[model samples]
Target chain A: MAGSELTNIKSPRVKAARRLTKRAFRDRDRSFLAEGPQAVREALALDGVVVELFATAEAETRHADLVAAATAAGVPLLRASGEVMAELAQTVTPQGLLAVCRFVHVPLETAVTPGSTLVAVLAHVRDPGNAGTVLRTADAAGADAVVFTDASVDPYNGKCVRASAGSLFHLPVTTGAGAGRVAQHLKDSGLRVLAADGAGELTLDDVDLSGPTAWIFGNEAWGLPEDILALADEVVRVPIHGRAESLNLATAAAVCLYASARSQRTAPAGVRRPAPAG
Target chain B: MAGSELTNIKSPRVKAARRLTKRAFRDRDRSFLAEGPQAVREALALDGVVVELFATAEAETRHADLVAAATAAGVPLLRASGEVMAELAQTVTPQGLLAVCRFVHVPLETAVTPGSTLVAVLAHVRDPGNAGTVLRTADAAGADAVVFTDASVDPYNGKCVRASAGSLFHLPVTTGAGAGRVAQHLKDSGLRVLAADGAGELTLDDVDLSGPTAWIFGNEAWGLPEDILALADEVVRVPIHGRAESLNLATAAAVCLYASARSQRTAPAGVRRPAPAG
Candidate 1:
């Protein structure tokens, strides 16, 4: 635990980051792992966040710019052995750089908004990569928020964060309890809930997605649960013409979210007018 | 390879099915890996194609129905240690079973009609999961085919196969030398090429997707190369209404493909009849 303060975290930070290897440790600490120079760079790019950056001496030597940026930003930079980096990293080959940052908690109250808003809701989606991709898509589609229902994989899971391609830092993503309550809040706020079902009464195209809408995508093993499906004001299917069993959950969510975006994007300018041009 | 000539694989033949592991051997022999009781059951469900099956003694004792089904289907079976099973299987946790079946290449040319065929032209999509998911989406959307441009991942990669969720077997997927030629053939077949771009002139809703169109989705990194973009008769985009950077490739493809499906699905039945009622 030498040089362990926030200003300098070498072995201690590496040891802490390594604990992320177990799901229990990650959950208990409310922290997860992120690796590779790109992931580290993105993590550092976020404002006002405390970060523990671990890099090999070789990496520090070779990528002086990265080290300088980390130092300048006041992020705790740690020198770690390649073996330690490998132990802490998920990839078969560690990229000689990793970051441990606090998980940003987006309050449900903050996520709720009036007027036309788009949000993505995940129900029982356990795969970290799928959850992360959904959040990334939500951000790309300009959704107002992302809500993860109970039993969904932790959005801050290392795999999910990495899968998000750094979009996790850019978006307001909230997990844990109150997801259902938040969904209801959005309902009360006038956003229609549309659950995506492989089999549903309405095709996604048939539904007018231009209005304030929340799209629900669920586990690959099962579509949205029956209760969630019942709660939705509308259940829509992304019309499938081919012979595959079903679209991947993440891909399906992206399609539905983008479909909403398409509808909003193509709305007549007169209809989509900003409030008196500010 | 005992009972190699047996038309119906029974209890006696089960002993002969275990030896097909080495990649060099699998490649030289034109056979590949398959796993899971469900997957094996699925393989047996198909008419008369099971060459051999392998299962741990535990699986044989526990899932008697699976062994019975394999026996009924005349597929040979082999018993192996759990360690051997782990080495032979692609997934980290062995499903206590494996299979070595002759590779069935779905001809790129098969079942394609020149008039009004819709296909996905995948170019340089290096991620195996993305490639497989795209192919699977193409299958689910009932597209005529999926073409892997030269730089795309090998469709046969285990990850690709796992991601495709068995659609790779049914979908008319082709790669390598003939991919560009196939694109040319698709164009000559009167299929208009429409490349998908993050930044493009026509949004998905703006474009009339109801036609014999080949939707081109590109690599995760650079997107559709300029040369490939130039080949397209038109360039189409999925409108981004959110603050996110870009939609994932498979998601983009799904949106385009589903848009096409939606347009075609809503068209008068007489306009495009179902292919001979299956």
Candidate 2:
């Protein structure tokens, strides 16, 4: 397996995979690439999400389990040379394994159920890394859903997917809705919508968040616009105790989501497991 | 004051500034360049921090207040052409201002005072962006001090300084110390030391952080090594309520620091101000 596959950077399959790097092509095909063993494994774990798997011969040997899993799931595995993998990979250094997966976003109605305790709505967020980070943070906080608003960076962006650290598959993600529409949807789902803005009326310490809630986080530089802030049930700011002007967007999201997670303490959803007893 | 000055990209000043990009050179000169108007302005706010300032004609006109500040502080001002500004700048597009400033780290004893309620220890964090964001988050959370241990990235790293968004000048930062020594220093200062590791024994929810607390965070990838974790009074994990594996380093730092800030509720340090009684 290590020496069999010939290098073919110009192959049609490779060319097709290469096109997914752009958002337009990814949208047209309704598919995107998940690079590295971690993301490939996560993609394989989800039902019908993974369309195909690609790995270098060396990687195929090193990650036989992923190859085996793909085979078991009836997903075809393509063994490519390092050169081909380099072509398929978006990173400067390709990790030798990548998966082309179907878009996994659910509709807003399906993303947030009535029993949802917390949700993170990324509205007007432009940075892919920040968007992905907040997605990971939301999943860690056990938010029921994460919404990427129309103005937000595509969840399928390569950098965002990598920054998510396999969290792209962990929780429900709803996309393409506007901030006001997402807020309304969350409100309709019986969740209190709170906008996290620097000019918010109340500080995080002064707010009560123990109920079903949705947090709206905005762009990294200019926070939520006035119209989006107006739709929220309340606007809250994370208190700043030093001379720093503001908190980073993802950091702010983590603080808000965890505060809600702390207050809610929903057990069955999952918590970071404790160390095994001695 | 502006257009009259010719750009000398090969001049001793520009070449010397360029060399400061490397840590060895920065340490040798006991100085680093703070680029952009925001950073330069913050550096000017501190006495003896700003040694000299460089600007292009356009930027000088745009930020006359900064020029006034530097003039009032008696700091040398150098006008340069766009080419010279680009030569000294680390970013792809130069922001047209740069300040060569002295190292700002304090000793462990000076950084974490007796009455300090919250502190952040970045033990072996290697990513400059993560380190810088954590520093900014620590500042926003009203942390008393932020420490960059021996294995940590240099706070003077160009990316770290920019990522800090001027919070680098807002708080006390102690650098080049080992994690264990820093831990001992915090313990001796009457603060409880908690190391944040994925394998941490107690979850944040199960712990009490209301008192004087110092949080130790490790490398982005491998987390804290065992020897360093053993040095902490306790190892705490932020709960991951969903299927996500872990939180990002900067995000974890934010949650932990803000938790302490909320519990401690120090009034005089200045919270991000409320909307000015509008």
lDDT accuracy of residue B155 in candidate 1: 68
TM-score of each: 0.83, 0.94
Q: What tens digits encode model 2's per-residue C-alpha lDDT throughout B1-278?
A: 33356477788878888899999999999999899988998899889999888888888889999988897888878898999888889999888899999999999899987777788999889999899999999988888899999999999999999999898898999999877788888887878899998888799888767677889999868989989988989999988889998888888888888888876774443432222221
TM-score of chain A considered alone, across all candidate predictions: 0.88, 0.93
Across B118-200, the per-residue lDDT of candidate 1 in tens digits comes to 78877888898888888888888888777876677766566676777777666566666345676676766767788899878
| Residue A248 displacement in candidate 2 (angstroms) | 1.0
For model 1, the stretches where C-alpha displacement exceeds 4 angstroms are: A1-10, A20-33, A61-69, A269-278, B1-27, B41-48, B55-74, B77-84, B149-151, B197-206, B222-227, B235-240, B267-278
| Top-DockQ candidate index | 2
Q: Write down the worst ten-residue block by lDDT for model 2 chain A.
A: A269-278
Question: Which window of 10 residues has the lowest lDDT sum in candidate 1 chain A?
Answer: A1-10
Clashing pairs in 2: none
